[model samples]
Target chain A: DAGITQSPRHKVTETGTPVTLRCHQTENHRYMYWYRQDPGHGLRLIHYSYGVKDTDKGEVSDGYSVSRSKTEDFLLTLESATSSQTSVYFCAISEAGENQPQHFGDGTRLSIL
Target chain B: AQSVAQPEDQVNVAEGNPLTVKCTYSVSGNPYLFWYVQYPNRGLQFLLKYITGDNLVKGSYGFEAEFNKSQTSFHLKKPSALVSDSALYFCAVRRPRGNQFYFGTGTSLTVIP
Candidate 1:
């Protein structure tokens, strides 16, 4: 909960629908990340941004995309929600993109049926 | 690429007993390792990290991690366990030049009363 806030703490959506999760931070950190948490997978990185408009794919970024229009906001979008996409999404921020410790938000739980 | 491994899928310990969650990592250069914990309905929280310097690094919640270079291991340990300490734990690693952290699958810890 380190100065990070994720919107839509819980959401139930249908398959094939589009979903967007928002992460806002007061810390103005240089790096932001989006991750999904599942039972067996633990947490997998979906996307990350080093700065505004700079984004990169992660290990599990196949169906998800992210955007950072401003330093304080990082958005994760699921182009077409799938049952497999039902998981808790977490956002984290760090002062630098290197080996620094990242602080996380509460997370947004999404359920797709 | 850096990687982390958490061998145990689940661990159960009685309250007030000593607890340990195993973690190991692989990286080319000097490795930067970390441990994070997640409670039910909560996001991941930073526990401890191993940079250079000391082999043992102390962190929040009275948790500590020992970095064993020979074994390439950074294990989380607590002298006394509490019921509140029962949660999901994740191990992460980052290379010296890497921009993102690589996380392990995670281990679920159950501290029994």
Candidate 2:
């Protein structure tokens, strides 16, 4: 409940379709991240942004893109969805950098058929 | 590359019994460790963290963790378990000078009544 909100709590789309997940935060934190959670895989970082227009890839960044035009909003886009990309995506924010604990949003459950 | 491991897939304990969730980590320099709990259909809630100083760190919800450098372990523990404590627990390690966090596969804790 860290003042974070994620749009489209649940979404279902077909393969090859494009999907975008939004993360909005009111806390004005310095860092925001996108992660995906899957069975037997836990949570894996997909992308992160330290500031507006500053982004970086993570371990599992393939087939996904992200944008942060403003501090309060971070968007994760799946250019072409696939069955293997179905998972629960979470957004997190922290006041400080990696030293501090992150607060998470409720998450978006996305399914690709 | 920093990583964390939660060896157990699930742990069962009777209510009022002591509970422990194991976590191990590998990092280059000093490690920043964290623990979180996730209820069904909810976001992760922060439990405790090991930054520096004392080997033992206390956190929300009557939870605590001991950071043992020799063992490279930061295990979440509670003196007595409760039915409400039944949930999925995740352990994570934060990379230095970055916002990347690596999470474990998660351990399901079931506190029997």
Predicted complexes: DockQ each = 0.82, 0.87
TM-score per candidate for chain A alone: 0.96, 0.97
- Determine the C-alpha RMSD for candidate 2 after optimal superposition of all C-alphas: 0.9
| Clashing residue pairs in candidate 1 (N, C-alpha, C atoms within 3 angstroms) | none
What lDDT does each candidate get?
Answer: 0.91, 0.93
Best by lDDT: 2
True contacts kept of 2: 0.93
Q: Worst lDDT window (10 residues) for model 1 chain A?
A: A94-103
> Model 2: per-residue lDDT, tens digit, A1-113?
68999998999999999999999999999899999999999999999999999999999999999999999999999999999999999999988766788899999999999
Give the local distance difference test score of model 2: 0.93
